[model samples]
Target chain A: MARILAVDDSAAMRQMVGITLTGAGHDVQQAADGAEALEIAERQKFDLVITDVNMPKMDGITLVRELRNRASYRYVPLLVLTTEATLERKQQGKAAGATGWLVKPFNPERLLATIAKVLG
Target chain B: MPSSARPFTGASELAGLAPVAQDASQLPPALPGFESFQRFWDRDNGCWMVKILPGEYYVSRSEEAISTVLGSCISACVRDPTRGIGGMNHFMLPQDATQGPNDWLDPAIGLATRYGSYAMENLINDLLKLGAVRERLEIKLFGGGRILAAMTDVGGRNIEFIRNYMTLEGYRVAAEDLGGTQPRKVVYFPASGRARLRKLRPVENRIISHHEQLYLDSLGKQAAGGEVELFD
Candidate 1:
């Protein structure tokens, strides 16, 4: 079971994610925004971090930039979860050090499958 | 597999999660009376986009209604029932977001031209051009949610300003659902003089907040020679 940090501004999305990831035996922690997620990340370790691209204070792309700068998180699996599916946006995330991209409104099966593949 | 899976064994992050977990647990009780969540999110949005800023309004003679999602921002739907013409306007507050508390009542910053006074006058003027009789205008207002949720009660101020404006202007307000914590999804039909409002859930509120925040952020960036695009 992987310890994953799920970051998004939506409470419902976080709860849905909490329910899904917990059901899969993974320890899930939720954060409201990138700034909050960064605070939690600094204090604890996670196997992977899933963050939405659009958020207040700081965005996911900027978060990936900051995380990648840290030596301890240099190779951490950072995934971007968002509704934008344009190639340019995906490339932007990839360029910003995201390991993979997951679309929003994701179902439990799709979310788990993505995590399993990434964690593998 | 990437180097990220190198098995760094560590303790759970649950120890310091009391408040965070409490907030997650308190996300508004299964959305009491809303329609199916999927239905609301996945409905056909084939209609025209009617998003307006502080001093903009769109009056329509077409049968279709103009829709907008509002936060602490307020929207007014005014129409003449006899002529079947109406419109909607969305405004953030009486003045610019950057305005200070001391400048709250700055008369030098004309209220009619700004969102507070102009937003209503603009919509009323548009309806008049589309054959609405001045004496038969019926107004309906929605929004004024505590979206900022900060120490400053801007939403309450906005609600009060609009109420007083209508009272002074002497427009007959047929219906109003104002001032609550939830952002609203409103559809104002110009031809039928009908209005529909849905008190959105937190997830839906996040969508609206994100959109407006980006727009507001863009305004700041644009003044400094930066461009911010609104994406769906």
Candidate 2:
């Protein structure tokens, strides 16, 4: 089982991601916002970091930049989940060093698939 | 039993509909002039309370006495004493009406700007009609979670419209729970103006996006005056 960190300001979204990942046998930790995710990442080792783009304190793009700056997380798979889906935002994430993107309201299969692809 | 007592026998019936639970007793103290009825469900760290005011309607899988159905849609709990009776509505969209201007067209919308706006107005009118004093009434709003990805803006828009409408109407907003990337299961107790917001975990975004597309397509069909098929 892989260790994953999921970040989003919405409690519901955090619960959903936590449940799905745990059900899939992955050890999952949750953070309320991007800044919190960074704090957790610094203290723990995770196989992947899946975050939402829009958040209160720190956004996903900024989180990606911060994570990439750390040597330990530089090679960790980072995926963004968002509702924007605009090409501009996608490019912004890519430029920030995101490994890939997952659109919001995604299906269970796709979530697992993405995780497998990133961690495998 | 007082006029404000909810008719449900146990919390399990309500719990079957949503995952969250609340203790019945810690609910907000009822407003002085308002009659109150409440039901509670105990869960891990919190409890869910279903409170109803006199002349207000409560609907869902829990009881059949009220026709108000709850869904992952937007609902605005409004109380205007000038109109008297406070009421709430479960609406899916901002201005997109699916059933058309038929018997289902809630007359309250005429008083407010959109569905969310009308819900607040109708609720207040319900309270007023029931003998509530208009100037003394207050409003508490809830619901408007991001149920579908395609309609991400809908929930935000609903919350914004309610805030703006209240501002324009010169009403005080006592409390609010709005805007997030998760679907929420909400319970609004009109009598005490208490609302419980429980977030549902994000399943795959794919399912949510699919549902959003269907809802939007349905809106388009309604606008075109055609029968809207919600899903493929």
* Residue B33 displacement (Å), model 1: 38
In model 1, state the lDDT of residue B6. Answer: 34
lDDT of each: 0.63, 0.57
* lDDT tens readout by residue for model 1, A1-120: 999999976544465567668878999998878999999999998998988776666788888888888787887888886655567978788888888887643434556777787777
What stretches of model 1 exceed 4 Å from their correct place? A1-120, B1-56, B94-102, B106-113, B214-232
Q: Write the per-residue lDDT of candidate 1 for residues B37-127, one digit (tens) a residue.
A: 1111112332223445533466665545567788877888888888766778887543343432223343222221133554455466456
TM-score of chain A of each: 0.95, 0.97
The TM-score between candidate 2 and the true structure equals 0.41
Give all TM-scores, in the order shown: 0.45, 0.41
Off by over 4 Å in 2: B1-232
* Interface RMSD for each of the candidates: 19.0, 15.2
Instruction: Encode model 2's per-residue lDDT on B29-86: one tens digit a residue.
Output: 4333333445444342133344432113432212211112222345556554333234
| Ten-residue stretch with the least lDDT total in model 1 chain B | B33-42
What is candidate 2's TM-score for chain B alone?
0.50
